[model samples]
Target: MSIARPDLPRRLAAEALGTAVLVATVVGSGIMADRLTEDVALALLGNTIPTGAILVVLIMVLGPISGAHFNPAVTAVFVARRELAAADGLAYAAAQVLGGLAGTLVAHLMFEHAPFALSPTVRTGAAQWLAEAVATFTLVAVILGGLRFRPEAVPMLVGLTITAAYWFTASTSFANPAVAIARSVTDTFSGIRPVDLPGFIVAELVGAFLALGLMGWLLAPRKPTTVPVATPAE
Candidate 1:
């Protein structure tokens, strides 16, 4: 069977655009929640539920074009697993970052803030970094685990895992590096500080790499048998 070589540029653009919408919806909901709710839990529920649905829906819409990797960590794992070519990963990551930046700016406008959220001096401390690593690890594991050969369900499962991570994990689960950066631009509930970005990114990358190693061990091809039975004389 012949499959057309995926247009890397088109896929990357799809990633960028999908990620932008994800960030926009997530952050915008946060900003609105901060205004309406006094309890942090309630505020977070408002942010995560819609984001989860959006992820599932958008991936179904865009997965055919982009493979729907909105996170650098996800793309990195794809490369390590030989699922995504290296050059393709690079372009997708670049596009995702750019889309995040644009989404943040637009979110700021919507929230009636210039900087949106912006990171603070103590923004995202050690606890947050640890949280990010764990969160990203869980997300990648679910993604890799749920759909080893079944590409059709990747989007929904990925989104469900993320929503569950947000519900259970600390730091409200920043499983996505690109989304983390976008959150920094908004001063709203979804925002993190710029100072915190690098640490989060590093942690996410590490977790993703760990998942990839596990995947390699579990999914490696078995060695072929050398011995064969002799054929009966005809």
Candidate 2:
């Protein structure tokens, strides 16, 4: 028996709820890590693992419903590929942003912090911008490549990519616009200053576009070579 596909509303809900949970995990873990450790490396390690783990869980659970595009950059790429309509992409992005903000609020409430506060953390400069771009490029590349080569492994690939990116990239790979925006509201270990949002967002978009272009060509199917059949001499 064939299963019925999810409707648009269900898809939107999945996108929103998935993004909310993802952001909540990111912010909550960061807060917990910050409070538990004075050592920056330890705090970062604590923050990184949960974020990666949650991505795997969220993607596996919500992927069928909405493609699990918790990131606007990913949504944009889908739109560009004509896999998703522009209007639907806009709606998805709105839901994602709203849900992400709600997640930040939820995290803060659980931690007894203010409902909303602008981050004081200063993340800026050319190196940081370059890092954000590189981080997002690698993230989108991994996603596209994984989907092409091993669709079943995408969730784990994404999770592992982010986990490694957190340690290697200077910006800690806030490669998602929704997550970046949500994170700007909390002055915690994962927060980025509001002023820095523009740069990071721009860099992320640039990176995503680059990945789409490169991966589109790389993953494209090539025309099979035609061979002339030789007739046997009778």
Candidate 3:
């Protein structure tokens, strides 16, 4: 039941490494899916499965090290909750974002494509923005709920939630702001236009805070009552 506490450097390394692989899983699978299939639905299916699978594995492997928070949004929520210190959270966020960029480059190199190209995939619209919000909200909700009620099951829950979100949300659930920013630089199957990044990131932030408030309210313990037990006070 007890795990050895990793030092800050090790924890940050785990976060960076885990997030890099996770982003690679996403972008790599999408590239492979696109190259291997003509059906968009099937390609998305291919992309979704591996991304979710890797997420579960990464969380299971690195959860104890860095809480496996590959998303800045998740880190922010934890910081707000006092579960993570602000400085640590900032480091985790930086590592995740940098790792995501590295992952995108890795995927591009694997595909024999030029890296650091701005995405031309325009994913802008009101419905898309709303979808981003909903997807992020649900993701944070699942994370919070799982951590609260079933800590052991958080990895699987998060993976499944993301997989489902890919299918349900119009924006394909780019729920992580780090991911949204990283994807903007890759002109690949999983890429999004740089212009669209702001809307998605903002929506994700809004959704994260909304979920934080909702989970706090929903999971808050009932306050104990004080009974009047005065003896001889007249």
lDDT of each: 0.82, 0.93, 0.93
TM accuracy, model 1: 0.88
143 Cα displacement, candidate 2 (Å): 1.3
Segments in model 2 whose C-alpha atoms lie over 4 Å from true places: 232-234
Candidate 3 stretches greater than 4 Å from native: 1-4, 224-234
**Which one wins by TM-score: 1 or 2?**
2
| Ten-residue region with minimum lDDT total, candidate 2 | 2-11
Give the per-residue lDDT of model 3 (tens digit) for 101-208: 999889889989888889999999999989999999999999999998999999999999999999999999999988888899888889999988999999998999
lDDT string for model 2 (96-174, tens) is 9999999999999999999989999998999998998999999999999999899999999999999999999999999
Report residue 35 deviation for candidate 3 (angstroms). 0.6
Report how far off residue 96 is in candidate 2 (Å).
Answer: 0.8
Residue pairs in collision within model 2: none
- In angstroms, give how far residue 77 of model 3 lies from its true place: 0.1
What tens-digit string does per-residue lDDT give for candidate 1 at 112-162?
Answer: 788554656344678877888888888887777766677788888877877
Pitting candidate 2 against candidate 3, the one with the higher TM-score is 2
Q: Which candidate leads in TM-score? A: 2
What lDDT score is found at residue 143 in candidate 2?
A: 93
Ranking by lDDT: 2, 3, 1
